[model samples]
Structure formats: C-alpha cells, structure tokens
Target: MGERTKKQKLILGIQHTLAMFGATVLVPALTGLNTSITLFCAGLGTLLFHWVTKKKVPVFLGSSFAFMAGIMAIIGDSRMGDPDFMEKLASVKGALIIAGLVYVLFAGLIKIFGYEKVNKLLPPIVTGPIIIVIGLRLSGTAINSAFYYNGEFSLKSVLVTVVILTVVICVSIFAKGIFNLMPILFAIIAGYLVCLPLGFCDFTAVREAHFLSFMDKDIVAQLLCIPQFKLDAILAIAPIALVTMIEHVGDITTNGAVVGKNFMVDPGVHRTILGDGLATALAGLLGGPANTTYGENTGVLAVTKVYDPSVIRIAAVFAMILGIFGKFGGFITSIPSPVTGGISIVLYGMISAVGVRILINSRLNFGNSRNLLVAAIILVLGIGCDSIPVYGAVTISGLALAAVVGIILAFILPEGDDSVLN
Candidate 1:
C-alpha cells in the first residue's frame, strides 16, 4: 500500500477525534469524573493498545460502558450517607487496577486454550442480547430528557425529541461521506439549535466560565493522586476484570473486521489485552475512567475508509495536551444536560440494536430452552436488579451487573451446537 498523504492523515485524525468527542466526555460527565483526564487516558490507552498490537488495526480507546454501573453504585452509596464513600471509590479504583491485570490472565488463557475455546463461551447469542438490553435500558433516560418532566410530561417536548431523533437516525443511515460519519454530532447540534427557540438551554454557566480556565480542579487534583491505597478496595473491583476481558475480545474482533485484519491472530489477542489492561490500570490510578475500544470511532472508520492507526495516536496526543490545561475541560463540562440527553436517546438505542444484531447474525435458536433461559435471565437481572447488594457496603448496577450475570450463565449452562465458546 502507498503511504498516506499528510492531509489524509490529518483528516483521519480529526475524524477519529470527532467520533470520540461525545462518548469520551459522556463517561466523565455521567460519573462526575474529570473529562480532561478521561480524554487523556483514552488517547493514551489507544496508543498503548496500538503499540502492543504492533500498530496493525485502527482502533481508538474510549471510556468503557461496563464500569458505568460500578461508578453509579459508588456514587449512590455515598449519597446514602455512607461515611466511607471516598474509601469505597478508592476501593473501586483499586479493583479496576486489578481488573486491568486480569486481562493479562485471560489473554494467557486464550493463548494456552486457543481462541475458539473462549469464543465458544461467549458467542454473539449471549453478547448481542446483552448489548441490546444495555441500549434499551438507557433509552428511557434519553426520552425523559428530550421531553421535560415538570412532574408532568409535555407533548410538545416529546414531539420535538422524536423529530430530533428521527433526523439523527435518517442522516446516519442515509447520508454519504462525512455526513454519514457524524450523524450523532450533527443530530445533537440540530436538536440543541431547535431547542434554543423553545428556551430549553441555559448558557449562564458558559458566560460565567473563564475562557482559558481548567474545568474541574478537584478532579484534576484527584487524577494527580487522591485516593490512597487499601487492599479491600483492590479486591472489590478486581472481579470486574473477568467480564471486561471478554469485552476486550469482542472489541478486538469487531475492530479487526472494520480494518479487514485478524487482530486476534496477527498482533495477537494476548498483547492487545495486555495493552488495554495496562492502560486501564494506569487510568484508574490517576482517577480516570476505565478504557475500552470505542464502537463509535469504528463506525467512523467504516464511513471514512481511513484505516491508518497513526491517526488515533495523533488524537491521543491532542487529548494529552488538552489534559494539561483546564479551560477546555470547563467548556465541555458546561454542555447542557438536555442536549446530552437528546443525543443519548439515539446512541443508547443504537447500542441495543447492535446487541440484537449480534444475536440475529449468529443465527441462534431463540426457541431453545437453554438460549431463552440464558437471555431472559441476563436481561432481567441486569436491567431489573441493577442494584444488587454486595457485602452490605456497595451495590452494582447497569452494564456491570448485566455482564456478570451473562458470564455466570454462560459458564453454568450447557452449550448448544451454535455456542460461540465451545
């Protein structure tokens, strides 16, 4: 292949950055973490992943949705007057640190046992449905935000939201070139623009904000190291590593398909997992969110036909540079909740659709008792019992619960002919 032109490389870099823009900020916004630090770590994580994988596949790392539950649970517990909320947060970080290490362990397992053995356990049948449920679960939040609820829902707001979402979906599916790649970003801008006439957004925060000030000082300090070490905290979060390891496999596979290369075999799954794990641990140590390969950026890659991994490295460099300063962070933090909510409705629904697609593409028999039971149990428990009591100190919610339940059922149930793990 011929070398990429400088302009092509620059375009690729910008596309990757824009693709990850909403998602990279969403994690920190939702979890009350440092947006700048999260972006910094995400970029760093992607670079590290590329390095370990020999720079073969073009994948950008971003915040993992898997840890959303853990973060919410910790924050919720803290709200309930748990005197050890900070301690619990520290422990959660510690667990993630260990979880990152677990990737190395799973990677070794794959090497020893072979990829098929692991694949047999987590076929699209299992993963697809879980992904769907995850999206559907968050859809409610999006819809609610689009239509203001002042103790009563507004029909006008709901109609407006539907229009916004429809426009986004249409553009994503039908638009060509750059338009197709940025459906979400465009949708958000359009939706917020429409809402401007409705008096739904407030720019007061932006006006009060300094043009060149860092966003969240507290988060930045914490990223510099605030939560001290405790063994219990490490143990609490480590179990999540088991599920995220599987997620890493799925991400690599998906990325490989996008780039038309077998990342699992070429750069080798073990090395890729190691890179992800280490980057995640480093992010956690510095009070940033856990990292994962972003599907949004993958969609951009698909749309742009740019397969260069170096573009992601450039994006990462940009993220690190942004992290050093604070004003950019403040600006992102100042984004209106309703605007985020409007976009999230579509993003979350797409996530669910991806899950359904996974199962459909796998051609799994839903009629089978084993398949039905596994899917039913995982969906309900994950979305239903989102909050599970753990040692009378913390609770689990959202993706973390869904993931754990899915893995447990996959392990316990008998594998059918279509099993991905067998």
Candidate 2:
C-alpha cells in the first residue's frame, strides 16, 4: 500500500470509508444526534488523531458503540418525534466531553506507567468479556431495530434483514482475497436495493434535502452545547472512557499485528491514546457521539493488507465531504431501519465472537476458578443489570462498572497457575 500509485490509494480510501459507513452512521441514528455533524467530526477527529500521533498509524477514528448505553441513559429516546431531543443530546455531549478528558487521564497513566502494567491490570480475561458484553448487551436493540415497523413487527423487515445478513455472511466466509474485505459495503448496497422495491425507504427526504449545508443545518441551534454542565451525566458517562481505552489498546495491538508492526510500542501507546482522546473530545464538543479506534476499519486493514496511513487519511477526508453536504447526510439518515437491523445482527454478533476469540487466543483457562469467577461476574454484572448503587440515590453503571469489577477481581484473585491469561 505504501508504494501504491495515488489513484490506488484513493480507491482503497473509498473502500475504507465504505467499511466504516454502516456502524458509524448507526450511532447518530440510534442516539438521535446530527448525522452530518457526526461524519464531519469523525473526519476532523481522524485528522486530529493523526496529528497527535505524528501520523504514523493507519487507524481511522469513528463513532463508538461502547458509549451507546450512557448516551441512551442521558438523551437517547427517539420517541415523540423527540420534542426535547436536542436538549437531551446537548447534555449527553457535555458528558461525552468529560469522558474524552477521562481518556486523556488514562493516556497519561499509560505514558507514565507503561503498557506492561496496563496489560497486566486489564489482561484478556477482563477486557475480553467486557468486549463480549458490549456486543451482547446491544443485541436486543439490533433485533428490535430490524423488526420494528410502526410499533409492530413486519415480515417484510425480517425478509430484508435475513437477505442482507445472508449476503454479508456468505461474502465473509466464501469470498477470496481482497473480495472478502468488503462484505459489509457490498451487503449494504444489496440490501438498500432490496429495500427500495419493498417501500422500506423514503427517497423524498433525499430530494428535499439541501445540496450544501454547514454543520448539518442550524435546526438545532438552541440545542448546541455552550458548555452545559451536568455532574450526573459526568458520573454516568465519564468512566466508560477507560473501558474504551482498553479497547483502544486492543485495536492498536490488532492493527499492528496485522500490518506486521507493533504500533503500541512504535508510535507509542500514549500517543495513540492521546490522539483518540482528543478526537473523542472534538466529537463531544460538537454534539456528536464519542470517537474511538474503529475496529471495523481495522478489520478492513487486516483483510486488505493495506498498511499505508494515506488511505485512512483519505477516508477521513471523504467523511468530511459527506458531512459538509447536507443531502448526503440526509440520505444516510433515511436508510431504512431494517437495513440497519440486518447489519447490526452480524456486527454485534461478530463483536461477541471477538471476545470469545480473545479468550481462546489468550488461553484463559476456564477450569481455573479465578478465571471463571472473574469472567462470569463481568458478564452477569454487565448484561444482567444496568448499574449498581454506589451512593445514596447515585449509581455506577454500564461498561464502566463492569470493567472496574473485572479488573479488581483479576488483580485480587490468586492465579492457580500464577499466569497472565496468555
């Protein structure tokens, strides 16, 4: 990829954009945030990430699914046409900004203490289940979104989802070489075409949408946060930054492994974390969801064997172009609900499967009581309950609590083999 012609880099960049499209837009769609702004922020954020890290890594930053629960808890309702939606969204943005700061704190800790300590503290036993929980916990939303039709299940959506799912899965398993790298993009094209004939999508919004608009329009002028502060929102959401930080390490580790370099050590983990943190803060400040090292884009890098950072930066530029054009954003927002559902089914499941892979790859001995207890507790704590009461009328919940619990258990419990999962 590094030696490719300029035209080839652009083509690969477009492919990377397509890989990130489904999951990236889904965050704004679910949280009722401005879709165009999200895209714009993602682009700007990626550029910022590159600058912060001295432009060494090829990772593309995008919307993070890990913070969905916190966003939902704060301002996530998509009902009543969302009369107060922006008000709720603005508040969430405030929390997300703080969360980004928390990410910086973790980055500093990593910089000072080094990766080995963080790795020992987190280990695959803790982080793997947390990843699985992040995916499995969102399963209900994925299914419900696919089947939902004016408050009723539709056989139409089911057929559509199934078709798309099948296409994606088949391409994933059977496609050879570079072809396997683009199943999501191909499947989406196939599904959207299927949706058009079935009357699942509305083209009217696209037609009515403006060709050019700044920041996704001035519609939410009042809702834009000028530093709206909420301690509760901070407490609810900020800690999850740490959870995503662990994920950042894994994502970078995976990217490095695939590209045949140790990004965690070369560009330095601290630099990468700093880049991600600043990018996320930019998203938060702009009333969008938090940003993270997108695993989907990393997957594309792995499959395509494109180690060049130029392609990802190009993809980031593409995202910004879509963001500045209101019409492109509108079309993406209006993608039929069920089409998203189909993608989510595969995506969320793949996430959980990655967790299982983490365990298998790490060789975490389930027969060992310590490993069993830690993993089991993290799952139940993460999926079974949303939060735990930590103070009078206050609670710690979501991935933050789940991750903290897992880390504590992993640290305190005795290892029968006196081993670190791997």
Candidate 3:
C-alpha cells in the first residue's frame, strides 16, 4: 500500500475528531465529570483497540450511550439528599471505574463461548429493540432541553435548534463529496455562528483561557478524585456492560461493512470485544465514561469513502493532544445546554429506533400469542417498571432491565414446531 496523501490524512483526522465532538463532551457535561479526561481516555481507548486489532479497522471509540442510564441512576441515588452534588458525583465516578471491569468478564465469556453462541442469546431481535429504546427514551430529555418551561415554549430556541438539526441532517443526506462527509461538523459550526448573533455563546472565557495546560485542570478539577474499591458499586454498574458488549458487536459489523472486510472473522470478534473491555476498564479507572466505537464516525466513512485505518489513528493523536489543553476543554464545556439537548433529541431517538428496527426486521409474527406476550412484557417492564427494586437495595432501569427481561423471555418462550413467518 502506498503512503496516504496529506489531504487524505487531514480529512481522516478531521472526520474522527468531528465524530467525537458531540459524544465526548456530552458524557462529561451530563455526569459532572472531566471532559478533557474523557476525551483523553476515549482517544487512548481507540488507539489501544486498534493496536489489539492490528490496525485493521478504521474506527474511533467514544463515550457509550449504554452507560447513560447507569450514570443517571448512580447520580440520582447519590444526590437524593446530599448537599453537594459534586461529592455525590465523585462517588458515582468511583463506581463507574469499578463497573468498567465488567467488560473483561464479558470478553472472557465471548472467548470461551465464541461470538456465534453469544449471538444466539442476544440476537438482533433483542438488541435492536434495546438500541431503539436507548434512543427514544433519551429523546424526551432532548426536547425538554430545546424548549422553555414557562408554560410556553421559546420560539427562538426552537427555531434555532430545528435549523441546526435540519442543516446537519440535510447536509449528511444530500450533500456531495467532502461536504457530505462533514455534516455534523458543519452543523455545529453553523449553529455556533448563529448563536454568536443571538449572544447565546460568550467566548470571553475561551479568550482568557491559557493556550496550553496539563490535565485540562479547568474541566478535571470539578470532579473530586475518590478512587476506592467498593463491591456494591462494582456490582451496580456491571450489568450495563451487557448492553455495551452488544453495541460493540454492532459497531464491529458496521465498521466491517464500511471497510469491506469481515473484522468479526479477521482479528476476530473475540479480540475486538476483549480490547474494548480493557479500554473501558482503563477509562473508568481514570474517572471517564466507558468507551465504544462512534457510529457518527462510521457515518463519516460512508460519506468520505476513505477506508484507511491510519487516518483515524492520526485523529486519535489529535484528541490526545487536545486533552492536555484546559482552554480547549473549557471551550467545549461552554457549548450551551440547548444545543446539546437539541442534537441529543435526534441521537437518543435514533437509538430507540434501532431497537424497534431489530424486531421489525426479525419478522417475528406478533400475531402469535407468545411473541406478543414477550415483546409486550419486555417493553413495559423495561420502560414502565424501569426502577424495579431488587433485593431491597438494587434497582434496574432502561437498557439494563430490557436486556435482562429480553434474555429471560428468549429462554422461557416455548419454541413452536410450526413456522409462523415462513
């Protein structure tokens, strides 16, 4: 293979960075964690994954949506009566670190049972609905963020958000060449520019911020470091790993389709799974969000048609470099809540849609009593009774509950001799 041209490398780096922009910052903003550390860990995790996979797949790792419910639960629990939310956030951070190790256990399971056997348990029927629920559940939060709560919605905010989302979606779907590939990036830039006229953003902080710094203290200093091993914390966070593992499988499949190679068979799904597990554990140890492949970056690849893996590696390096700059970290934090909430509405909805799509594509006859019962029970229990009390102390919600219920239903539902779909 010949050396990649400078333009190609630059484009690849930009693509990876752009793909991560929304996700990397959103995790820290929501969890009261360090955005810079999150970016550092995300970049480091992606690099580590590529190393384990022999740099075969052009992919970038970012914060996983699977952990959102877990983080929210932890924060809600810790902050119920606590005076300082930061102190509670610190405890949650410690739990996140411990929970990250659950990935290793799942990786081991994959190694022992192989991907095929695991798939039998978490087929698309289960995973798709889970994904869809992940998105749809979060969509409510997005819409709430985009509007006002004064018994009347803010038309200006709504218009700005819609315009921004429209620009992103339209460019992504209709634009050509490089323009088509950078819809998200372009959308963000366009939104920022619009906000400038409306005084929605104040860059004075960015201007005053130091050009270079270590650990991005402005962001990292907010969350106090309280690293301690707690068994319950570990157990509480561990269940979410199941959902993330399933997501990893989908990411590998998507990356393979983009690069035109069967990564599941090449470096092997087992290796990729193990790599993601190790990376997630490492990130959590440092008080960062669990890492997973960025679907937005995958979309970029589909648009750019540049499948070179090295380009993504370059982007990872850029993220690492940016992680050390307090100014850059602060600038990202300054992104208004409405902007994030606006985009999140789309992102979270997409997650839920993926779950629904899985069931639809499965072609399971809903007319069948068993199928209807399983789906109905799983959806209600997963979404409605999300906060089911377990053993008087533990509570499960959203994707975690959905996954557990789905697995149980899959095993309990009687397999009929007559084929309904056929």
Candidate 4:
C-alpha cells in the first residue's frame, strides 16, 4: 500500500481493462444480449465481487462463455436486430439469475463441509467431459455464423471468414507479447477491414446511429430495464451453474498460482464463490450475461506485476464509463457477423481444448471402464444433442444432460478400483 504513483495505477488500470475488453463484449456479441448492458453489468458485478470478498482479491469479473449454451438455447438463433430478440433474451436473463443461486448454495456447502468434501461430487472426469460438451455442442453455431447470409451461406462470406480466421490463428500462435493475448479483438478488426473492401459491411446502421444516446429509445425500452423472469428459461439455464462452479474453483486456484497467494485460503473459497454468485445474479438481473472471474486479466497481472486491487477497480470504472455511453455500444453492434464468427472459431475450439487439458493433467484412466463410460456418454450426449432435442426439450440434450449423467455415474461408479477388474 502507498507504493505507487496515481498515474502508474491509472495506466495499469487501463491495461487491465484492455485485457478483458475483447472477451467481455464477445458474449453479448455472440448471444444477442445488449453490449452496453453487458458492459454495465460486468463493471457493476466486478464491484460487487470486490465488496463481497472484502476487497482483497484482485480478480476482474467478465462475461462467462460457460453460459453461452444456455443463452443460445433460450434465444434460439435470434439475432439482436430481430424484432422479438429482447423478448427471447429476457428468458435467458431469468435462467442466469437462478443459475447464480447455485453458486450461493455451493458457497454454503463449502463453508460447512470444506473444499475437498465438495470435490467428492465433481471430479475431473465428470467436469472435464461436461466442459468439452459445452464447447463442442456450440461448435456448429461458430461454423454456421462464419458463412451465414440472410438465410443461406455464400462464397463471399466464406472468403471473408477464412481471412479473419487465418489472421486470428496466426496472431494466437505466433504474435509476441500482449498481441498474442488479444487475437479476438485483432481478428474482429481484420474481418471488418476485409469486409469494407468486399462490400459485406453495411455502414448505414452506424451512420444513422445517434451520436449520443443515453440508453434511450429502443435500448432503454428493451434491454436497459429489470430482467423479467420465466420458469421455462430458469429450468433450462440453472443447471449450467453446476458445471461452471467447477470452473470457478479452477479459476480461483489458477489466480492463486499466478499471484503466489492462495486466494482459495486467504479471501476464502466460500467468499469467492459467493462473490461470483452475487456478481452473476446482478448481471442477469440487468439483462446481461453471467459474470465470472476472468483469467485474461490475471495474465495481465502476471505480465505487469502490479498487484494492486485499486488498478482493477480503476478498470471497472472505465468499463462503467464505456457502458454509460450508448454510442460505443452502438459501434460494437455495428460490427458485422463475420467478424464475431471468425473469433468464435478460435474461442470455441480453445474451450474444448481446455477440457482436454483438464483430463490429461488429471491422468484420467481409461483402463477403468467407469472413466471411459462417463466420458463416452458425455460426448455422445453432448454432440448428439442437436438431433436428440427434435424429439423433446432438446435443451436438455446438450451439456445439461451430459452433466447430470456424469454426476450420477461419478457418484455411484466405484472409483476405478483395478482390483475389482482383476
């Protein structure tokens, strides 16, 4: 404390904001939630997270990809420009609110029983396959959006998509320093630039967009109000919180590793979980996506070596400022679909790869039929989700079904005792 100048903190604050900027906006961009509302909720959520954690941890809350499937299930391929998009999105908002409560329940359990006791329920095998399903299940939307037109795919769309995708891949694989961390933002820029010359971009919306609107007109009337709850959406979405809670613990542990301070022990894992729940519930209530602690900003802290919570608070303030200005959100909305699609290709694939890493690091033994069976059923249920839903509430087919099955199997399946097989 009292070690750095104000200017240094401000610079570090802006850097933190930039680290989270790309991914924070991507959720709304992908799912038809309001960009400004997402920003507003993210900023507010981060502040609430700090408050709940007693302002000790330096984590930044951002849009959660884990909830993307739930959001899409509720919204059902509707674009933000659609007349009824807001109506559909309201249901998803309700789902996220219920899902947030799941975190609170976990927090209570952790406080009473401790982390290891809770871990008995969700091991790597179960959580890993559930995560893989979340990513793989959403894979088709990434592909379809890459080449999508008014109602059909086209060659021009493919060309634009390939260029942006290639650019993002190169940046992610080869670019140096911070550039490597920001492939999404750069790829979107690359796609927009390519589209300008190829006539894919429509600047009419951007031009006609008001210079300064304070969340007025259609924005306030739709996304800027209180989240409306629906039972159908809550049932559809709340189940996902089960999976993401595992993710939350992983993120907290990772952040602890980076900062060399066991956040799970210090600020306490229960508090962190409660913080996330509060932040997520607040975001959902405001019609934004779920909020989770972002690993991206943790990377920024590792790179910059600035551990001040003040810096992250500064970034939260900056996010709020950007959110309050409606035009910046309008500009984000003006970005073409191909741009978001190109980024999704890399983002979605990386999510699945993370699951693979989890399984690999955990040394999951396929020799145990239990492990194999759990993984197998999860993958089949998740990937086959698309066709399965046509027969029923298909919403249950994806991550939701796989997660339930994996949990039950993990609970009853004797822990791969080789002696039993022998």
Candidate 5:
C-alpha cells in the first residue's frame, strides 16, 4: 500500500466511525444506559485496546450485546420514576466492573497456562451454542418492540419499523463500497426520516439539548455516585465474561484474517483481552455498558483493505469528539422504539448467524450424542431458564447459565466418532 494523504486518511477514519456508530449507540439505547457515556467509553476503550496490544491490532471496541440481558435484569425499568433508580444503576455498573475484572483474570491465566487450555474449556460446540442463545434470548424482546408500542399495536410504529427493516436489508444486499458496510447506520437514517413524516418521533429532548456540552448533566449525575457492589447483580452479570471472552478471541482472529496478519500471535491474545478488560472496567466506573471488539469495524477493514492502526485510532478520536455533543446524544436517545426494534431484528439475527457460522466452520457432528446433548442443553438453559437461584439473592441465568453448563458438559462428555447426520 502507498502512503495516503491527510484527506484520504480523514475520509477513511470517518467511514470507520460511521460503521461502528449504529451498533455502539444501539446498545445504550436498548439498555437504558447513557448514549454519551457509551460513546466516550467505546472510543476510550478502543484506544486502550490498541495501546495494550502495542498498537498492532486494528480493531474498535463498542458496547457489547452479550451483556444487554444482564444489564436489563439488574437495572429494570430505568425510565420508571423509582427513587432508587440511581442505586440500581450503580449496582449494575458494579456487576459490569466485576465482569471486566474476570476478563483480566482470564487474560492472566491465558498468559500463564496458554490460550490452548482455555480453548479446551470453551470449544466451538460449547461457545457457539452459547452465542446462539445470547441472540435468541433477545429475539422476543426485539419482535415485541417492533410490532407494538407500550404493549399496544400501532400502525404508525409498524410502518416506520417496516421501512427501517427494508432499508437495512436492501443496503446489506445491494449497496456498493463503504455504503454496503453500513446497513445499520443507513437503517437508522432511513428510520429517522420515516418517523418524521409519520409522527412517530418526539424531538423535544433534541431541541432542548446544547450543541457543545462536554460536562453534561447526565455525566455529572452518574459521576456523583460510586458503583455499588451488590452481590446479586454481580452474580447475575459477572459470569457472562466467559461467553464474551471467547467472542473477543473470535473477533481478533477475524480481524487478523482480514488484515493478513496474526494479531493473536503478535501482540498476543492475552494483551488484547487485557486491553478489553481494562477498557470495560473503566466504562463500568463511568456508568456505561461493557465494551467488546466490534465486527462492524473489522468488516470495514476488509472492504477498504486499510490495515493501518492509525486509521482506527483516528476513528476512535472521532467517536470521543462526538460523545461531547449533547444534541447528538439527545437525538440518539429520542429515536422511536420501533425503529430501534427493527434494526435490532437484523442485529440479533446476525449475532446468532455468527454463532451458526462458527459451528459450520468447525463442522461439529450433531449425530454425535455428546455434541447434540451439549448444544441442546445450552439452548434450553439459555432461552428457557430465566434465572437459576444460587443463594439468598444471587442467581445465574440466561447466557451465563448456558455458558457455565456448556463448559462443564464439554469437559465431562465423551466424544464418540460419528458421521455428520442431517
């Protein structure tokens, strides 16, 4: 590759930012976390990840969907006028902080025992199904939000949602170049425009928001309280690191494949995980969601064929700059639920599809009773069981439950050689 001009670099950076913007903001929008803080953490986390990996890995960190369930479970109904809402939010952050520390702990173990051992504990059959469960668990919520508004069906909401979903599908299938890599952003724009004419949007918050407010009230308010380390919330949310940790490795490997370099061998997987861990911890402290490696940005890397870490850093800086714009945050939060829901349908399905791809790539034989049992148990536990009570208040459920059980089954079950049976 030849040396690029400043203008070229700027455009590339902006393209990368747009690629990540939709999914990053969507997490906070869904989980009732602050959009501004999520953006700031994503940028900060990406920078932190790059620094820890010695600036060798070209990747961006964004709000993770894997933890959205835990977040919602811990901090239910954030819009409700509960006097203790802040306290509940603090507990959620505390749990997320623990989850980040777990990543660091795993990173340390990987450094000592090697990633091979960790892989043995979380093979494709185990990790892949757990991932599928994560997406499926959210499927009902996505559908309900898309088809209804506050438990009632609305024609306007459905119309806007259909338009957004159609735009996302068309862009994903038909758009060319950089635009093809940004279905989510295009869907959001299309949704916003559609909502405007249909009377589905309320722009009051955006109208009242300041153009350039760095120290916004939301940030200030979140900063005032220390994160609460409640045992129940911690137990519910922290164990999810097992699932996302595997995802981090997958993302890094995919990014390396795109860039034609082995990031896992160079900067090392441990360092990358450490970077992700520390970034997520910082986010929890600042009242934001957990951070994970973003595949969207990696897709951009593949399309543009620009593997420069500097370009990714430039995108990170753009994210942080946008985080300070109060109006941008307001506008994002004000998006109609149906539009968000429509985009989520594709997003959630894509997540499950990634898991399916993992299984397909591994070519796991479902005819083998061990493999079938492991996957079936994980699917049922993840989607069917809401929470498994462990103690007085603490419980393990959802993705965390499936992840824990899958690892155990993977260890104990004996693999019998069987042909792939359809």
Candidate 6:
C-alpha cells in the first residue's frame, strides 16, 4: 500500500480504535478498575511500546484477560469487609507493578539466554491448561453476574443475559466484515436496550457526569494513596506474567506474519516484551488493568491492509482522548453487571477454548501418561485450590501456583516415545 493522506490515516485510526474498544474497556468494567485509566494506560502503553521497539512494529497494547483472576484474588470480596476496599485495591496495584517487573525480568532473561531456553520452561503442555484455568476459574463470577440482581436471584436478569448471549452468538457467527469482529459491542447494545424496559438500566450516573472531566474524584483519591506491596498479593499476581509473556510472543509473531516483517528479528522479541512490561507497570502505577498486545487491532490490520505504525499511534491518541471524556466514562461504568456478565460468558469460554486449541495445534499426546498427568494436575490445582498457604501471611494458589507446579512436572517427567503425537 502507498502512503495515505492524513484524512485516510485518521479514519483508519478510528477504525482500529473501534476494533479494540469493546474488549479493552470490558477488562476494567469487570475488574472494578477505572475505565478512563485503562484507556489512558492502553494508549500510553502502545506509544511506549512503539518507542521501545523503535517504531518498527505495528501493535497496540490493551487490558489483558490473563490477569483477571489474579487481580480479583488480590482484591478479594469487598463484601467480607476485612481489609477496606481501597486497601485491597492498592494491594492489587502493587502486585501488578511487581507482575510487570516479572515481565521485565523475563525480557532481560530472553535477551541473555535467547527465547529458546525460556520457551522450553513453558511449553504448550504447561501453558495450555494454565490458560484454560484462567478462564474456567472466573466462570462463577460470570454466572453470578448473569443470574443475580442486588444480591438476589432474578428471572429478569436471566432473560437479559440470554438476550446478550444470543445476540453475541448470532453476530459472531453470521455478521460480515467488521461487524463479525464486534460481537461483544453489539451484544452490549442489545442487552442495554433490553434492560431499559425491565428497569434494569440506571442512567443516574450518566446524567450527573460532566462532559469533559479527565478523572473522577474517587479515582483521583485512589491514585493518591501509596500502592501497598503485600507479599501474598505479589505472589498471587506476579507469576501470571509467565503466562502472558508467552502470549506476547504469540501476538508479536502473529502481527509479524500479517505485516510480512520479522519483528522478532528487527525490533527483537526482547524489545517488544520490554515495551509490554513497561506498559503494564505503568498501568499498575496508574491504577489500571495490566496491558498486553491486542490481537484485535492486528485483525484490523489484516482487514484494512494498512500496516503503518503511525496509524496505530493515531488510534492510541484517540483512545487517550476518549478516556478523558467524563460522560463517556460514566456511560460505560453505568452498564449493568448482568449485561457485562453475559458478554463474559462468551469471552471466558473463548479463553479456555484458546487453551484447548494450543494443545490441539501442538498435537500433544494425551494418550501418553506423562502428558495426561501434567494437564490433569494443572487443571485440578488451578481450579480446585482457592488458596494454598505457604508462610504466615503468604500463599501460592490458582493459576500462578498451577503454572509453577506444571513447569516443575514438565521438567521432572521423563519424555516417553508417545509424549507427543507424530
């Protein structure tokens, strides 16, 4: 493609922004993080990633689904009322900052040892189930969100969820062009409309919201506190980087293939990983969700055949602009939990499905006892154990613990003839 005019670039940038919008904001909506901050961090992170990569790769960074379980664990159930909610939230931010550092640590390791050694440590067998666990672990939250209203069972909530899911399923399967990639967005719209008649929708926040405030006062207060670095929370959140780092590799590789550029060799995987780490850490510092390379924008690249880094930068700018609009933030935050819950059902399932795809694509032999043991252990430990106590106040549990155990088992279990299918 030839160089395009500014008008063309601006339009393409908006298209890319649209492509990433639904999923990016959804992370904050689900996690109780600020939507504006998530958008700001995502935009800032993309720009930072581009600068780190010398502007060679065409990529956008957005909120990561991988860290959702870990983040929620750190935040804990506010209803319990043990640690104050803001304190718990501060711990989450602290842990995520450390998690981002874990990525930075891996980036340094990859730069020194090469990606191959790190690759062996987290092979498909270990990672696939871990990814599955990330999704399946959150399934309850999705269910509760779908079925409950004001902490009570509501048939009306169920109806709303069904409408959202039905719309999502239909759009994803039957819609053409960009619409095919936007099932969640369409579902939210449908769900919101359905909710209005049933008195499930709330417009009070939207009505009270300013037209152009950058940050809400409550969010500003949260940012003002020092981030608490609890050892247990750090252990919970940091190990997740092991999984997302591998995901970063896949996303970069996919983007490279789409653009016909060897980004791994040019900007180098280490550089890309560093950019991601910095972006994620920035998010943690700013009280936003962790950042990851967005595959959605790459899909836009494939569809539009526009591979320019500058256009991606333009989209990042647009995202930042959107973040500061107070009315927009209120509108998103006002979306009913059940509506987002319905969207989560599909999204969370897809996370697990991605894990299954990884195993299938690698042709890992489940018939082999070693392979079976590794996967079974990861699935059980990850999903079964809510928290396993380690020391006085610390524990290793969930995906982080599962990943650690799986990696050890992968190394310990001797490879048999049928370890992987031929």
Write one digit per residue (lDDT tens) for candidate 1, span 241-323.
66566556656665565466777778777778888888888888877788877656555555445677788787777666556
- Badly placed stretches (over 4 Å) of model 2 are 1-12, 15-19, 22-33, 54-58, 64-98, 215-264, 295-309, 388-396, 418-422
Show how many residue pairs clash in every candidate, following the order shown.
16, 0, 10, 1, 0, 0
Model 5 clashing residue pairs (backbone): none
Give the poorly placed runs of model 6, Cα more than 4 Å off.
1-35, 50-102, 215-269, 284-319, 389-395
Between candidates 1 and 2, the one scoring higher on TM-score is 2
Residue 16 alpha-carbon offset, candidate 5, angstroms = 6.6
Clashing pairs in 4: 389-394
lDDT of each: 0.66, 0.76, 0.66, 0.72, 0.78, 0.78
Positional deviation of residue 151's Cα in model 6 after best superposition, in angstroms: 2.5
* lDDT by residue for model 6 (81-139), tens: 34487888888889989988988887898899886675577777887787677668767
What TM-score does model 5 achieve against the real structure? 0.76
Tell how far residue 14 is off in model 5, in angstroms. Answer: 6.0
List, residue by residue over 187-249, the lDDT tens digit for candidate 3: 666766766676677677578666664434544454345655555555556666666665577
- lDDT winner between candidates 1 and 5: 5
CA lDDT, candidate 2, residue 348: 69
TM-score of each: 0.75, 0.80, 0.77, 0.70, 0.76, 0.72
Query: How well does candidate 3 match the true structure in TM-score terms?
Result: 0.77
Q: Number of clashes in model 6?
A: 0
Top model by TM-score, which number?
Answer: 2
